[model samples]
Target: MSASTPIARSKSAALARILDNVPKGYHRYTCGTVAARKAEALAQKFHTLYGIGCSPAQRLIRKGKGLANVVLVMHWPVDAEKVEWLLLATDGKGLETETLRDVGDKQRLKWLGYELARHTNRAKVMWTWRRTKEEMTELHALIAMQANQHNTAAISETLERIARQPGFRGVRTQSWALCEAALQRGYDGPLPHLYFVQKTNHGERLALD
Candidate 1:
């Protein structure tokens, strides 16, 4: 039987071990608006330290846990639609966490870990579709490299770029729409400012001037 939660020294570190097994395709959508820069920054740190492409979408861990906990907010890579936000957490053990948001027909976290499957509750039906690996790879390369080169003014150009992809079929889901919005939301800081905080010992975001 899997433990109810993680029991690793660092939740982020433990999660890195499970990301490869989450069953997501190439990570194309990364980087978010000013509101999400903190998460993106932390996601880069996780990638650097653990090699798993993860970002914190929502970091609302209540106060008081004798253990280190990290909530990684992200979308399932396999789902090209990006309909829902997948919240993954880590603990003192392995990758054990509860999904924060599930707004789609299928719950794809079965690959995260057994503990997560049990804890993942609620699923709101949303857009569903299938995408090719080539599409995903192209999007990732285009968006990631020019992440800071988009804004409300360049929305047309950005959309055009995505639409011009080899097999671009167009956005089919609200999740994909939201993901596009984030891409064009523009960068708030010169560089991403990662935030690592606990309710008890909450810390300010690390933004370079």
Candidate 2:
């Protein structure tokens, strides 16, 4: 495919975002046994050429399809927020990694599956299936704060800060979605920027392998 192709452009955009968010020397882990092996295999394939290494965990399935719903465990270096990825470098070969930085465009799509892995990064996972109670409570709080005409920047900042706290991570993402859903139900209140909100289309389902 040509470099200017649409798919190439999409991959380039996605790859840029992934590379930017994924810290140097940090790798990702895919949760679950089967998903983990797939991630490991992908990482092993390009480990010799690229230093990126993703590892897998020995857990069972949780949600989504195949690797889609497998929670991603990111392993961060000290001083960085921790996350995990699958496709681990073999023992003693810590240098070998599963990165897309230097991989070709064709090969890039293969690793895109990693994106489906359950991720804590707000940019990756938009809706949180866990912690619904906390999320709902926070959602109402944010709406109330917005009604009080809090500074949009402060409101956004608060959302970010709160989302990072234990038991509240991804609350911001879900908040936006919930607010949107509320609006659809004929509620009115000051709301944060609604640009990032996403919703599931009716009848859509994850393709099972």
Candidate with maximal TM-score: 2
> What is the C-alpha lDDT profile of model 2 across 96-151, one tens digit per residue?
33232322222222233222213456575421222345446766667566646644
Runs of candidate 2 exceeding 4 Å displacement? 1-78, 81-83, 86-133, 141-173, 177-191, 195-209
Candidate 1 C-alpha error for residue 107, in Å = 20
The lDDT values for all models are 0.32, 0.33
Model 1, residue 119: displacement in angstroms?
22
Model 1 TM-score, all chains together = 0.20
lDDT agreement of model 2 with the native: 0.33
Q: Least accurate stretch of 10 residues (summed lDDT) in model 2? A: 1-10
Clashes of 1: 7
